[model samples]
Target: MESLFSTMIVLLLVSLSCFTSSEALKSNKGNITIKWDLISWTPDGYVATVTAYNYQKQRSIPSPGWTMSWSWTSKEVIWSIVGAQTTEQGDCSMYNENMPHSCSSKPTLVDLLPSTPFNQQIANCCKGGVLKPGLESAFQIAVGNAGDSVKTVRMPVNFMFTAPKQQYVCGPTKNVRPTRFITADKRRVTRALMTWNITCVFHKAT
Candidate 1:
């Protein structure tokens, strides 16, 4: 009889533990995500598009916009960018001329203003980092001194996302299937060379 009673108590504790663990997982589910798609390989490195999506039903990222920062796992530089630009051009003194956009191992990027010239614009870009619920913003980047192929490329780490009075916790990047796109004429289809995703969950400030 005592053995039976002890078994019941252990089972109850296990059930409660399972329930709490399940709830914690649900609460950690991401509401925002960033995706990086390697569009094509360059002679020196590659060109890719980075997009941020806000999946929250009612939340939005307002003006002065989102700022994202990450540390390259290897010696990488931003040769050029479109639709958005890095906040600083870290010491390109090594290059004599035609310097890269940013040389910082850890770079911060922000969206361009709406008044940006038409020639400098790309689809879903230049919104000044103002993201609406269920919408996305994207920017293209030319990375230099990095791997030209998927096997050699390294993913950035320590991704930090910031918005007005909001905090987001970003998860480690996960390599995913390539992204596919249909031509404007709908006659041809193409896919990215590689793709990865980083999800961020909004945590209310205490």
Candidate 2:
């Protein structure tokens, strides 16, 4: 009777362990994941091209649905937004050949004032649509042209992502208005950020 009781207790413990393991798997099923990559960076006034990939099997996710802010400082030069492009496919047609081929607006080269924090809404940046999984999307920001002055600076950018509130089954031609993306609760959204610096060197012909 003692041996039989011991075996019964062991079986009960094993069953409980399996139940906990199954719960863990169920909780993580069909969850969305985000992957970021610094695709390319050129010191031509430090153009940083970054890419974001959705790793889930479902539909794409919305970006900066909550908040995205960046700031910078430089002693001798000012940072500007010369050109930018955001799309679901990682295409560089607009940013190639040292010219903006397909941007909606011309290169503005807006200045980034010293010690001043800037938000996406104030910058008037275009809002990107849903980015499908297995396919990647990219954002490219070009600063001012490289000059003779030697300078090194860091630009810190932070943003969040969330599922879109409105669901539409339509073609890619749907234009996403920037106003559609209002600032959301930070506590409820997913957050990520990156900071990269650039050092400019001016070389003179001998």
Q: What is the C-alpha lDDT of each candidate?
A: 0.88, 0.33
Per-residue CA lDDT of model 2 for 118-177, tens digit only, reads 343223223343445555443455444322222433333222233445221111111111
Model 1 lDDT per residue over 55-90, tens place? 878788999899999999888999999999999999
On a 0 to 1 TM-score scale, where does candidate 2 land against the true structure? 0.31
Candidate achieving the largest lDDT = 1
The TM-score of predicted model 1 comes to 0.85
Per-candidate TM equals: 0.85, 0.31
Candidate 1's C-alpha lDDT? Answer: 0.88
Tell me how candidate 2 scores on lDDT. 0.33
Give residue 157's error in model 1 in angstroms.
1.4
Candidate 2 residue spans exceeding 4 A from truth: 1-44, 62-128, 144-151, 166-206
